[model samples]
Target: MSKETMPAAEAQSYELAFHVLPTVAEGEVAEVFQTLKDLITKAGGELGVEEAPARFELAYEIVKHLEGRNRKFSSAYFGWVRFTVDPAKVEHLDEEIGGNKSILRHLIIKLTKVEEENPYFFHQAMAEQGKSETIDLDEEEAEATTATDEDASESETDSEVTEDKE
Candidate 1:
């Protein structure tokens, strides 16, 4: 009898992106990240880029009441985190996030071939198109050029009339 080894089971990984309510104070960054990382790892995936681990900009002025309350309790900041996880574990991860208020919002989208297109690449392509369009004279320039041509033709007609009279 020929011996054969069974094919190894394939585990698909999924990329996840989500937001955190606030940042960790002082040296507590590790604690916060670890807590999140541990949760994700337990769910069966590895954490990826935690973009802008700290607040970069505010969408709007923190309302006075919110600010006061936040200060009274603790400073609240907005953050974003990305990670790669097993497809099966993603459900658990989502459930956990849904159960936590600290996570303001989260989205888990399947990355298909079409969705995997780089947004930056699209942006660059659009920018190049914009540059080309900018190089070409716009509608206003075309109109101005046409007006000047008409004015020159009118001046020529006036000169022809004077010459004919003379």
Candidate 2:
């Protein structure tokens, strides 16, 4: 097929989630994030929604082979980026990310249409959920206090009636 007659490959949406090694200094974390974005751009990716890296404890220890030795980590800076790129370019991006020493682990997933249209902000939702839980706890404590007061008054009334009858 002639180049002019060939149909252009459709760009597909993808999300890249990564955990940066804790060894990376706090000040340099942003630099690492920028470098990742640059790599995607170089691969002809159009960047979309993204969350900046934030330090968080991992669910379990992660071991990575670095500098000819195995290193274990309990926490890391985590973040994700959404982008659209030709399917053929994804492999190249994956290989580049795999070679980066600063990244402890990374994953790239092709996004469904629903996911691409509505990006979820996990951290923000977690914060909001925490606030709502706190409010619920306070309300439960208040209800308990009111119930205790009602029980105390009922017990006092019963004792007075028994004394009067005697």
The number of clashing residue pairs in each candidate reads 0, 0
lDDT of 1 at 130: 69
lDDT by residue for model 2 (30-111), tens: 9999999999999999999999988887877999888899989999999999998877788889989988889999999888
Q: How accurate is candidate 1 locally (lDDT)?
A: 0.49
Report the error of model 1 at residue 140, Å: 16
CA lDDT of each prediction against the hidden true structure: 0.49, 0.82
lDDT of 1 by residue, 1-166 (tens): 1111223333443444444455445455445546666787787776554543343234333432233464222234334454555455666677876565454445665544454443223334545786787554344576543434434544656555443442
Superposed Cα deviation of residue 41, candidate 2 (Å): 0.5
Give the C-alpha lDDT of model 2: 0.82
Each candidate structure's TM-score, on Cα atoms with residue i matched to residue i, is 0.44, 0.74
Clashing pairs in 2: none
Q: Please give the range of 10 consecutive residues that has the lowest summed lDDT in model 1.
A: 1-10
Give residue 147's lDDT in candidate 1 (0 to 100).
34
